[model samples]
Target: MVKPATAADGRWDADPLLGLVAGCYVAAAVAPPVVFAGDAGLSLAAGGLYGLLLGTVLAVTAVVWVAVARARSLVVRLGRSRARWLLAVAPVGYALGGFALLGQTGIAGVLAFFAGLGAALLGIALAAMAHTRYVAATVDEASVEWDGRTGWPERARRRWRRGAWVVIGVTAVGFAVGVLTDRWWLRVAAQALFAGGVGFAQTGQERRYVCTEAGVEQRLPVARRLFGWATFDGYTRTDEAFVLHRPWRTDLRFAVADIDDPEVLADVLRRHLD
Candidate 1:
């Protein structure tokens, strides 16, 4: 039986369940095309079957992860469980339309397209998981620091380079595939999904970052191939920081910090401007 979380425990106790659900959703989102790839015809029955399988996997994985978290004392079980019904209901989530797409392709082509879609979804799901892990680690550790050196610059540079590589690689592969197959539609679809995933992942990474002791030096692609730094404007007394421009192309409130060396950091930022 699921237990209720105590007042003292609050929302934090339920985080593990949320994580489990997220993981399952990711799995459900990615699995159908994988299974349908083996066969070329799609039907409602086939989709339902896949949905059931995917949902069960997600529910089971969630349960197991929760159990592990409990074992490790990472989360305390609430006497009242909100997720019990979710386990039972989640299996049908995949049926919402994974197999339905097959109808658009006339069963046979549906089978092929579904296969492609599922494959693409699988890649996206994996990327989501990786991103979640990174975010969770950063939040839990509170380890992000602005060491006020060239570290921020170097890291930013790397991030920009990595993003560029992803965009370029995906585009290049899509172009090559298009050329070889002479199928503009297939190439376009493939590149759309692949390149879009790369863009999303890189963007997410850029959104959450800290400037290490290294100088702030990252290049970002804008409307053109322009690159720039995460310029700092100054700081407010309330521990809020101001930067002339948002780094990583994200809009965020200032990062709050009460460092021992605000003056030096300010000077460094000013120097970069000059």
Candidate 2:
């Protein structure tokens, strides 16, 4: 979690002006590819390469800037402020403008624009989610009862394996159809199905869980999720695991063996649920 900056610590307070500057930098980095493509008569691939180079340079520059003690404070403040949302809009507008400019070039340019836009949007979403998890982990007065890594329970593993098998079967059928019908799109669909099946098979192969005062945090390989106390009605304890009951979502099961002290963990849950 990002700690608040302090004058006493010789750190400057967050400045909204710094945030505006950062937003401008981001816009400049992301918004020039389409213009470059049109003016230089560049191909779709060249436009994408140019965008990648600009984004990489900007990321490196931002990293160096944040490494400075005073600038780091400003970055933390910007992340926590409402102004950050407004800053995000500038990039979206520029990206849309770039897309419009690319449309005049050709269909290939339009497709390249959308592909880059999709990747940029996804990266932003993941960064936001990670920041939220970091903040949630540092909730005030939150005590951590148990923290460890574990895999899915036998029941859940069996269910996932069954689902994976079904998906794999479908993928096989799709591949056969693609070969018989000589359809490139069908082949692409088959490849996607195969990837999904593989992902399903690997789901929950490893996970880290933290039971804290404010909530339970589950960290997967690429994602972090928090299940707050208010979201769950209660929990049920079995010999091997604790199952948290949510009103509208699937229950979360934590293995008892993964906890250092099951009784202490139970006490923490009781204090919240009871």
**Candidates' RMSD to native:** 13.4, 7.2
Clash tally, candidates in order: 19, 0
> What does candidate 1's lDDT look like per residue over 118-141, in tens digits?
434543443333333323322322
156: Cα error in model 1, Å:
12
Q: How close is candidate 2 to the true structure, as a TM-score?
A: 0.59
Residue-level lDDT of model 2, residues 1-274, one tens digit each, is 4456456333322333333334434444444553454345744465665565567546644543343335554444544454645544444555555566665645434544554454455435534543453444344434676677766677777898899999999998999999999997698679868987997897746588777765777766655566778889999999878888988766777777666678877887898887
Clashing pairs for model 2 are none
Evaluated with lDDT, which candidate comes out highest?
Answer: 2
Error of 2 at 214 (Å): 1.8
